[model samples]
Target: MAGSSFDNLPLEWIRAFEAAARMGSFTAAAVETGLTQSAISQRIGHLERRLGTRLFVRQARSIALTVEGDAWLPHVRTALESLRESSEALFGVARDRLTISASTSVIDLWITPRLDRLTQAIGGQITFRTMVLSTDAPHDDDTVRIRYGTGDWPQTYKQPLFSEVMAPVAAPALLHKDEAWQDLPRIAVSGPRPGWTEWCALTGTPTVPIPVLRFDTFASALAAARAGRGVLLASLPLCAADLSSGTLARIGDATLPHHATYWLIASKERLSRTQWGALSGALTLR
Candidate 1:
């Protein structure tokens, strides 16, 4: 705000108004910024009084930016991003901060091993959090969420990660190539997800395998498979490492085309340009 006509304006007022406008709700702004809803309201009123114009049109269940707010939004957003960049340049990123919400299978099999690369790509000290979400779990807006399904999550932005092909993988010890594949023991999981039934149809293999065990999570099933317990249908990409390391072996050359997709999502509120740029590039499909 230096060297400007509005240099005397309080920075907090601008920050509060920016949050309220971007979140489209005073309550949501308060939740995101750790301010009280009443405080957000008061700050908006204070800012409007100083500017001598209404910035928000309050409604029963929603809030919309007025013409004045709409005009000022982009400038404020750019200024905030600039301020953050300048502060980082001077402070050298005091602490790394990021949080991700994803499924256990993705975390254990896919993202966990690649965390070092992600950190290196971001180029800074970082504290990362991973929340294990179920396939049908709701989105937690406070962190970047990974979803498994069609690219439709309400009130958020979606970025495709990678769709996974289904395949049968098990420990090499469990495979008996001379024996009939359908007669082998099959491990399964309990969820609203596809499994050996779908895989059998895709590969033209018989669905007459006997079930020996049923786990509740893919991680557990994978562990059992690696221990030479039984064959399990798993996502091809997620288990690629195990396949490469000779821990898990595919039953045959048959592979099913990908259907379920993995998507990275963020809430509707705008983020710092630098932060998004760093993460979005770091997460780009390899």
Candidate 2:
């Protein structure tokens, strides 16, 4: 076993090791891999023996990776991922239907507006899954994802949808009120986006009153602003239609730019070059 080569290692044993390490539980690994718990344990045991090293420290309720296991886990994951991607790219069935996962705000405000052009360009049917959290992982069947980030995901094809620019906006009726835009009530949205304080700092404006209404999701906040509840710090790209339709008016010329923005990412292994080109070309802002 001391001189055992990787060529002799079984794929099942490697899969078991990877699953157990990622899940930190032999039982959970079994569930994911559709194998019995004892089988997972046996495979991992054989793998450890073959490598002449203890991969995990067994505990009554949980397992923790040994130093050597932790060090090697990343390499193992990368190799397995490469193998899966290559197999899919070279031999997987091609489907005309694509599933995209994204936030409700992005779907309603950004993608929906471009749906017709996108559909015509890709020549496919599209399905949408609304993301509950921005940080949620892509679903197993999702072919594409619209994520809010700086375009730094690894091993995937990604492009920014638009530059991240934000400004204060209010319903036309709200803007017509005698009160100055700065004195109007503010709508606050909770998340990573910069808030009223950051806006004031960037614009060199004085501190404003606290928000009278706050919503956790951007969609809800945008709705409140559309109803003239308050002035909202809105993403210009997402609210472009609102601004164009006279549903919302910009408060001033000042805008805040951000390093992060919405990114359209696709599975490199799942999409062919032509499909990827059409999808990206149709959705990306010029």
Candidate 3:
């Protein structure tokens, strides 16, 4: 069918078909769209009737896309995503709102408290939602993002927020209670690069091999350190509050270049509104 021909299809059927295609299961799509599985199947049936083709092939418990359906997925995804983006982009001009995706540590420790100040500086009542995303760029719903990485963020218009400094930190109790920090369990946070391996090189203590405790996020690792479990490699800006509030203390004067830096990124073609510009500025200022 031609591109314009899709407009002839019912909106409800199109929604069901796209959801089913993406999820590859009628039940999953139904759960997502708040429709019954039978309803989803009926809508897809309607869509298939309109197109005069099969969209899915039923397996034992799941559904698989037909060849045509497989080919159509990206196009449908792009079309729907673009429509949603445009709707949000043009949403209410005077009361524009922006949704941002970022890491949890950045949001909880940095942005949440400073959001009011950011709104005040931007001169609008712009609403925001900070979702934690796995990737560096904004996904299907979000238009703006703050990512932690090196200066070069993948395939997006990214502005440098700031580079992070890496150094060892521990709770005062942990350091005081244990004289064998070199042998005690050490907490590790995941990123491009982690641990005292590089930091030790900077401080000239490479042979120091402390037992490692791993956490997927810096917040958890910092929490472990604050709980007096062990020392953690702290990202300076991300742990400012902990350092300031005396919850954690530096293990030594050792420092090194962190592999990750905070970045404010957006899709170049997708971002054109004044609200986005104000949001971008607000992110860096805080």
TM-score against native, each model: 0.63, 0.67, 0.58
Q: Rank the candidates by TM-score, best first.
A: 2, 1, 3
How many clashing residue pairs, candidate 2? 0
State how far residue 119 of model 3 sits from its true place (Å): 3.1
- Candidate with the larger lDDT of 1 and 2: 2
Candidate ordering by lDDT (highest first): 2, 1, 3
Task: Kindly list the per-residue Cα lDDT of model 3 for residues 163-214, writing each as its tens digit.
Answer: 6788888888877773666666677766665567766666666445554678
Question: Which candidate leads the pack in lDDT?
Answer: 2
Runs with alpha carbons beyond 4 Å of true place in candidate 3 = 1-95, 121-138, 151-157, 178-180, 206-209, 268-277
* Model 2 weakest 10-residue run by lDDT: 132-141
Off by over 4 Å in 1: 1-5, 92-108, 111-162, 170-180, 190-193, 197-207, 216-220, 223-229, 242-286
Which digits, one per residue and each the tens of the lDDT, describe model 1 over residues 1-286?
6446455678888999999988889999999789999999999898888787899999998899999899999999999878876875675533255667676776777676777777875565544455544445564445567667667666345776666677788888778556765677899987645777877777777877657799887788889889988888877777788999999988777777665677777753433445555565666545
Which predicted model would earn the best TM-score?
2
TM-score of 3: 0.58
Please give the lDDT score at residue 58 for candidate 1.
95
**CA lDDT of every candidate:** 0.75, 0.86, 0.73
* Structure candidate 1, residue pairs in collision: none
Considering lDDT, which of the candidate structures 1 and 3 is the better prediction for this target?
Answer: 1
TM-score of 2: 0.67
